[model samples]
Target: MNTKGHCCPKYVILQAVYFKLRFTLSYRDVEEIMKIRGVIVDHATIQRWVYKFMPFIEAEMKNRKARVGKSWRMDETYIKVKGIWCYLYRAVDKSGNTVDFLLTRKRQRMSAQSFLIKAIINNYRPRVINIDKSGSNTAAIKVYNRRSFSKIKIRVLSHL
Candidate 1:
């Protein structure tokens, strides 16, 4: 979305978000950076801008992303959110391009299935899925393929 009101230029907003995300900068750091660039913006405003524009930016990137190959890699890792551990399911194409990711509290079969479905919807169905030796992931792929109209191959790898 373009700047509609008496707001900062779109490039400035984009630059602020880019700095904040690309670097390990806090909102205040981003604000100072923007200030050095001659754009005066509050840290809270920067936070609001990130919260508002991140999804739009991601959607635009997804639309512009290159076509993924047939083979895909799927994996899950634990991430600490606030203080508790959460499961982060992520997928990537054979070329190492990011497909999609999902964060959930539980790492169950249903969660894996949901992550796979979301990845398929957002990106594309993979011809072959390589995953670690997780029974839940295997079961989820099995159930999803069974219910899905397309037949997808699942390869269990000892190490991903």
Candidate 2:
């Protein structure tokens, strides 16, 4: 982010970096884009800018991420990872934005409880959670509610 001694202005460097990251374009492609924009920046320079600025950009993005809604939909399912099956526990807000996810080797009450705890820690506790009729998930929520004395409503989707 510090552009004190650079020949190009901050905006030009930022544009090149943005193009590279946002479009997943190669360094040479970004250089050509800068050339089309009359910037004349080199591919190597663009690469350097990306290497230097990507971490800062990622940190800033995390800081600017929107807060998830209070209503969440939770689920767990099997997913293949490197040809190995795993349980993917996930939660999303009513707007469909991801609240949190965890992949575990086992599908059990402990795993479900861990995922719920992680989601609550990372985001705010949901007012209500809609979930399929999974016994482990139901038990996990019940335990969490009992321990925390929280009256979080659980709406079981029997049709799922």
lDDT of 1 by residue, 43-91 (tens): 9999988988888888888789788788999999999999999999999
In terms of TM-score, how similar is model 1 to the real structure? 0.71
Off by over 4 Å in 2: 1-61
Error of 1 at 42 (Å): 1.8
lDDT tens readout by residue for model 2, 1-160: 6988887999898888899999999999998988898888778989999999889888888788899999999999999999999999999999999999999999999999999999998777899999999988899899999999998899999765
Model 2 scores worst on lDDT over the 10 consecutive residues at 56-65
What lDDT would each prediction earn against the true structure?
0.88, 0.91
lDDT of 1: 0.88
Model 1, position 158: C-alpha lDDT score: 91
Q: What is the TM-score of each candidate against the true structure?
A: 0.71, 0.64
* C-alpha RMSD for every candidate: 3.5, 4.4
